[model samples]
Target: MPPVKKIVMWLVVIFLLYAIFTSPDSAADIFGSAWDVVANGVRNIGRFFDSLISRS
Candidate 1:
């Protein structure tokens, strides 16, 4: 990838590590929220496809 993209990725990694180390509870909450978001996204996609299949 490009240099800028690499730098941004490293920064994100460092920030996540700092967050986890500094506050475990806050980090757990953040990860839980992220999981919920991903689960909702997958559920929505499945519903969309199910609707299309039922209509046809």
Candidate 2:
């Protein structure tokens, strides 16, 4: 792995640890919000595909 990638990964790990130790509730909220955004995008894509299939 590249040095930059290692450094970035380490930084992310440290930040996560800090967040978890300091405010676990907020950390959980953050993950939940991110998941919702991903799920919404996936649903939108599925709707688009369904519309295309209906048209054909």
Candidate 3:
């Protein structure tokens, strides 16, 4: 599991680095997509916690 996690992490890092280094447009797209994903994740987490707190 640890090895798999490490490999996945490295793959993501390498892909991001490649994207950033290869083309500015592609890098911008990648960054935008990543930002969207992170923002959505944070929103979801906040909603979940809020719901939990409200229920309690």
- The numbered model that scores best in TM-score is 2
Model 1's alpha-carbon lDDT is 0.98
Q: What ordering of candidates by lDDT runs from best to worst?
A: 1, 2, 3
Q: What's the TM-score of every candidate structure?
A: 0.88, 0.89, 0.61
lDDT of 1 by residue, 1-56 (tens): 69999999999999999999999999999999999999999999999999999998
**What overall lDDT goes with each candidate model?**
0.98, 0.98, 0.92
Model 2: residues with Cα > 4 Å off, grouped in runs: none
| Stretch of 10 with least lDDT, candidate 3 | 15-24
lDDT of 3 by residue, 1-56 (tens): 89999999999999878877889797898779999999999999999999999997
Candidate 3 regions with alpha-carbon error over 4 angstroms: 1-18
Writing each residue's lDDT as its tens digit, candidate 2 over 4-56 gives 99999999999999998999999999999999999999999999999999998
- Give per-candidate clash totals: 0, 0, 0
True-structure Cα RMSD, model 1 = 1.4
TM-score of 3: 0.61
Q: Decide which is better by lDDT, 2 or 3.
A: 2
RMSD to truth, every model: 1.4, 1.3, 3.8
